[model samples]
Target: METGIVIGAGIMGTALARHFLKCGHRIALIDPDEAARAAAAAQIGPSEEFITAPTPEALPAAWGPCHFVIEAVPERLELKRQVLGALSRQFGPDTLIASNTSGLRAADLARDMTHPERFAIAHFFNPADLIPAVELVPAPATSPQTMDLWEALLTRSGKKVARLRADLPGFVANRLQHAMARECFHLLEAGVIDAEGLDTLTRYALGVRLALIGPILQRDLNGIDTHHAIARYLYPDLAANTTPAQVLDDKCAAGMLGRKTAQGFYTWDARQERRAQRVEALLPAVIALARQIETEENDDAEMGEQARGL
Candidate 1:
């Protein structure tokens, strides 16, 4: 069992700790907040392989040298740099250092590190335990060994790894997400659709289609020529705002930050919260079905090719 240290005891960190423990790996969760540590322990339940410490200095001697460290602290470049620098000092050069940043560049984070080659990005989605997808991005200075190490580790741990060729802003997933979100918010501002209609449209249309086949593959099946034509017609009319949507800004300004605050575009009641939980709970099954379908399609194509040869 590999020994992993996860810094930050927030939702993503706690989920990652639990996931590692479930994979029969030893994990040390570090957070300065006593309350956050307590809450994480409670959420994960008692496990011999799992432990929590307020800092790396407090880690027990029995945990051994960390094989990997995932820094899941809040999204701030300077804070991440500080944490990573400290971790680099604490651990040897062999230990892989990864960030769970949603968008920050790995090269920028490794700028001040002693061993830039050992650092990379391993961005996990929320509810990291349930989310099967992980975007692995490496810094320009990051060694191929580091990328291979993380790819092997996460894949062995049952993650669907998307190794990005280059570290760009927001990586792959978030950029696609925000692009769609931009249009959604733009439609909202234009009074073309309400929040409910928007969710309904996305849930039934984009979500369902994209779940089975990725956008590129779906476009191929739909004829890329048609997609190109549509894009040409739609591009000019789409939202091209370089700043945050005014509606989103106004909502944040009013402290109506969605489910956490019980309001945003819509007021989230207990029932709505339960529905949201249900959706997340069902995501794994949906992803499984999508994979199964993809496999079957590939098999059918192979069989067809064999028949044609015969």
Candidate 2:
């Protein structure tokens, strides 16, 4: 098994480390806080043997010569540059460095690195252990051999890798999400629907439909002609703001942005926390259904090939 090092003890980073341990990979977790490290260790349980480095500076000396090093730090450009530069100096030329940046350009992130050729972005989704999709973005300087190796490793670890051609902000998924969110905000600003109603509409209608078939497949099933007609009519009224919709603007102005702020679309209190937990509990079943669909597709392809041979 390949050895890996994950920097940062944030939710996503800790989850990645836990998943790596589940896959039987040797892992070294680099985080500054003792409490955070203890929390992460508890999450992984006592059975798994993994090393923890107390600081970023200690990472290089403690976990050198790792096959893969994933920097799951915050989405700050300078901080990532500093970490990558240090890793490039410490690790071998062949060590693959992956940044878990959401929408940042891989090329820009790798620009100051001494060994940019081995650098790439492996943008894993929230709750990394549960979400199987990972965006594998390569910089222009990234080597083909390095890309191939990391792709294989991630695939073996049960991640669906989408190799992106362009290093656009928000990559692919978040860009789509932001676009939808913009429109949702615009509607709320116009008083078209209440927050609860809007959430219900999405959870029941859009969410269920998208869960069964993705955007492209849904478009294919609905017929592109109908979609084009709808798009032409609705496109003109859409909000073009970099920020979220007017309802969100009002909320921010009033200092309500959800659970964090205790106010936003919906009012948040202890009761809201319970509601959130109930909503989140539905995800595992949804993921299981998605996996079943994927397995059926694979089985169908295999049977078709066998029939052709016969």
Candidate 3:
């Protein structure tokens, strides 16, 4: 029912566009490269509504009553600001603007926009369409209406959105993700465990439980006093530095970017990358399992309440 404009035409952008199209919204995909557009088409399929171009300047004149725009360009603070400025000029003040930045603070990205209140961070996880979780970060300058509208819109699109309390660096998920990564790299560098050992233990041990009960609930089940005691004893050994881990920095310097370059902590090739894509397909099942678990818990609580009343 709405016309949505998504700028970038990369993996995230195309995924978003595909979702929008499935929801019966017309989409205009903007990207500067023809090859990028072609690749996107290959992923999402060709459609008249899938308008592609260098910029918003090339948006179809018929894309009327466009209420939402998601800028999904690469993670560069300056580049995002520039693109946002251009979007503000094109769409006027009323149109809702969102950035799919993974780490940049919403306020910093909206600093240059003419109407800062219209901007927010709609940080979709990788493979936006497949990932149900989206971190909704709003700057203090962002309007309350913008927040409400986006929460409703994304929810209607079958997204599980977490509206963060503060628009700090890295948001919520990324901070936790990097916190884990930093420690893993530190341990790897210290020769405490090999990469495969770390990965194997992580998959079979931490990953399975985490997929169901969250860390906070796990702490509650384990007892707070026990957790506090462990934290007191273990905090000193954890990686708590601001600097990038030397192991990670040196790997990037060597251009051993995993999956794409076929080298990193583990070797990768085209076949490996293709196999990894299968992992993404399992997310729907995981989401369903989480939902069912919560529903069963809720039902049990309700039955207990009824029995107590009787």
Candidate 4:
């Protein structure tokens, strides 16, 4: 079994370490914070293949030459660069390094790295263990080998690998998500829809369909010409604001942050628990249906290729 070193003991880091353990990799979880490391160790439980340390230097000498090392620290460019630079020197040249940054560009992160070619972004969504997809982004200096290695590793871990053509900021998933959020916030602020109605529509209508076919495929199914026509009429009316919504700003100013503050767009308490349970129940079912759809599409493509060959 290969070794996987995960730096930072935050939520993403611990979850990723857990996933690596499940994938049968020897894991060395490192965090500078003693308490954070302790918390992660507790969360991950005890395993012979697993070890925790305050830093890579603190770990036992034999953990070197790991297969991969992923940094899941805070989303600061300089901080990430510092961590990665140190790691690049600590590990062997063959050890592929990755960042779990949500938005930072791969190019920026690799600028000062000791081995830029082996570094890339393996952006995992929140609750990494549960998320089935991981975005693989490579910097200009990154080697094709690095990309292939990451794709293979993530695929082996049961994650759908999405390779991007360029190292774009915010990447694919976050850009799409923020675009939707921008529009949603604009609509709410304009009184076009209330908070509850907005969420209801998103949960039932948008979420259900998107999970099955995704956005582009859904557009094709609904007819791109129809979408084009509607866009012509609606584009001008859509939100073009570069700033955060006034409603969201006011809520933040008042310290009414969601869940953490117990209030925001909605009050948290029993509803939060219920919502969490509902999502936990629904997501696995949605993932199952999506997999079935993908298989059918693949079968149809194969048949088309066979027909052409005949």
**What TM-score, computed on C-alpha atoms, does each candidate reach?**
0.94, 0.90, 0.93, 0.92
lDDT of 2 at 13: 84
Which tens-of-lDDT digit does each residue in 258-298 have in candidate 3? 87688987788777677787788787787788778878999
Using TM-score as the yardstick, the better of models 2 and 3 is 3
Expressed as tens digits, the lDDT of each residue in 37-95 for candidate 4 is 99999999999999998888888887556889999998899999999999888777899
Task: Point to the candidate with the largest lDDT.
Answer: 1
- For model 4, state the Cα shift of residue 185 in Å: 0.9
Clashes of 2: 0
Q: In candidate 4, which residue ranges exceed 4 Å CA deviation? A: 297-310
Q: What 10-residue stretch in candidate 3 is worst by lDDT?
A: 56-65
lDDT to native, each model: 0.92, 0.85, 0.87, 0.90
TM-score (C-alpha) between model 2 and the true structure: 0.90
Error of 1 at 259 (Å): 1.7
Residue 5's lDDT within candidate 1 is: 94
Q: Provide the RMSD of all predictions against the true structure, rounded to 1 decimal.
A: 2.4, 2.4, 2.3, 2.5
Clashes by residue pair, model 2: none
- The list of candidate 1 runs beyond 4 A from truth reads 294-310
